[model samples]
Target chain A: MMIDFSLYVITNRDLSRNKTIIEVVEEVIQGGATIIQIREKNLPTRIFFENAQTIGKITKKAGIPLIINDRLDIALAVDANGVHLGDEDLPLKYARKVAPHLIIGYSAGSICEARKAEEDGADYLGVGSVFSTKTKIDAGEAIGAKKLEEIKRAVSIPVVAIGGITLVNLPEVIQSGVDGVAVVSSIIGAESPFQATKKFRFTIDYLRKGKIC
Target chain B: MMIDFSLYVITNRDLSRNKTIIEVVEEVIQGGATIIQIREKNLPTRIFFENAQTIGKITKKAGIPLIINDRLDIALAVDANGVHLGDEDLPLKYARKVAPHLIIGYSAGSICEARKAEEDGADYLGVGSVFSTKTKIDAGEAIGAKKLEEIKRAVSIPVVAIGGITLVNLPEVIQSGVDGVAVVSSIIGAESPFQATKKFRFTIDYLRKGKIC
Candidate 1:
């Protein structure tokens, strides 16, 4: 599967301003989020599945790909576009073998892991703790944009930088040669997810093309 | 599928006196465990998948059902007989929809959960921390055999008593009318897993039929 996405938005209910995942997803899509990842670390399975199903409807209506985090079952259950996995989650090869059609995104902290993920048939790579953020507790020590560039060079698959990526540091992260940036708190935590997403979309495009379109 | 296992042995490498999971699985099977659940809470995905595959082979040779604890991907990847889920794991219905051929065991601490699992198509129920033991830290308060009886009555599917079950309490747990007992430390952490399994098998048989032969 060819993964073409920019300004990837990850959903974190705790970071949102009392907005349901559906509301935030709708807002972000209007703001130009090309991809959506439902990353629920603490929800029960039933609620998680329902949320994914509800969000899947919105993302589908907008023609945006829905990515489920750390759960192949939920991804398969809700028929999402892809499933994202970290080091502690299911390995990429197993997920590929089980669901060949779904785009599998692997989280890589180093170049070695990035190369392995590509070899293991991951459609894309999410490389991060890029700027030391608290959104994901186990995201590990901040690897910095320097490491992101190194990893992007090491893997052939599309690399999406994640963790602590805000407007201030997004330029540096974008300049790291990554294909995209996945934001959690920056968009979901903003006063207006729609406006936040529009700004992110503008910044990402501006940085990539060297002009404000 | 008809899950007819009496002695359900759960593998915990940490308590295995440095023995590998494969070693403990082989020992327990020889001693007469009818089913095996590969429960690796801390193992990375690759190693966990490898262990499940290796253990799957042993269980297949012996014609015993192999269940992966809390990971549906690993169970599906290695073609295990089932995947056991707890409150925090993937919900039973989603797993059933994805893998209908695989048995789905659900952990239910109360009758409400047990009845819900049955409605959701769980093949069996693991009702426990039947007694207070250190094997499963999250097994919660020891529900005792009395609660097991109540849960067993509330559901039609087979119920397996787990957590802190020992030979001394085996009669009470069995007398609670549970179909089987899933033991962790009692078997994996025993000095002689084979002998311990033999003892469990004999006791379960004797208690159920009131005869030695």
Candidate 2:
């Protein structure tokens, strides 16, 4: 599947909060997220699968491909659009072999990793914790705007700035040379996810027009 | 969860001839494969998940932990013991945070990866494609027994030898110091997965005891 180069949103799989991953996913998709990823941490397999399948069905229905974070099985199970691998995940080439047509993405920690992911045929790179994020307990501090510039200059694929990226900093992230932004709390924990995603979409639209959203 | 240091087997997902994953997994479990990983590289995700869910139930029922070869989502869904992250899968540390108690394993391409896997907090390492096998197409030639030895010496966690491991080459793989063996065609692709696993179980038992099984 060709990746949606616009905006990518990382879905939170906390069944308790999400209650219904598909329901919540539908709302996010409606908010204009082109790509969906299920990044649920620590839950029984039963819970994750049920949630993945539910969300997968919703994302598929929306014509937006759902990507599983880290788990190939869940992605395969839910027939996700593809997978997003972190610096710690499997290499792109091998993952491609596992699911030849999968839209494989890699997280680049260093410029070298970003370049290597491109060399390894990664469809895209999720490149940063642009700002501190509460999603992860110990995310390496922001990889820095300069690091993003170096990585962007080094590769030709889409690079989405992650880690604490939000509407407030969307302008800065885009100026840093990222193709898009990846958000968690900005959408997951937002008062209104729909407005949040639309706000992000507007931000990117403005940026392309040589302004800020 | 603590790993079953005794023996682990890798195989093409048993969804095909076995009809459902549960049946295939139960048969192998009976033969003493403590860990079962689904590595169905060529199938579609929908079919793969159907099969994985079936086997996941079986493994969960039998008290055996099922592992998804390279996908973290499937593992999360089935809550099979953990995930076997190929060099191409997500990094082990993030995987650990996602499934804090889940056994996070890694494929080691070099001592550097193993060291990082450990510091990043990996549970174990699948050291090599012990020998070349048709089961694993285009796999880099076996890292030979030496790479396994070097990895074993370098890491403190238990190591499982992978790739082309089989009964005939069992001795050499075990001698290399890996804690267990993960195989493919040697069992699942064989005419009698039952006998194949028995042979592997016996071989591993003998090797671990430094005697004949």
Which number leads on DockQ?
1
Candidate 2 residues A38-137, lDDT tens each? 8876554446767777787777778887778866655665667888876445445656665677788788767888888888888888887677777861
Query: For each candidate, what is the lDDT?
Result: 0.87, 0.72
In the range B17-68, model 2's lDDT, one tens digit per residue, is 6434455566678888978887766453345556677787777777777777
lDDT at B163 for candidate 1?
86
Give the poorly placed runs of model 1, Cα more than 4 Å off.
Answer: A1-4, A12-27, A40-54, A108-116, A127-157, A168-178, A188-194, A207-213, B1-3, B12-23, B40-47, B108-116, B128-157, B172-178, B189-191
Which TM-score value belongs to model 1? 0.78
Which residue pairs does candidate 1 place in steric collision? none
Cα lDDT tens digits for candidate 1, A1-213? 345578899998999998998899999999999999999875765678889999999988888899999778889888899999887777777788888888999888888888888999999989988988988833677999999999999888899998899999988898888999999998999999999999999999889996532
Candidate 1 — what's its lDDT? 0.87
Sorted into a CAPRI-style docking class, model 1 comes out as: acceptable
Q: Output the lDDT of residue B116, model 1.
A: 89
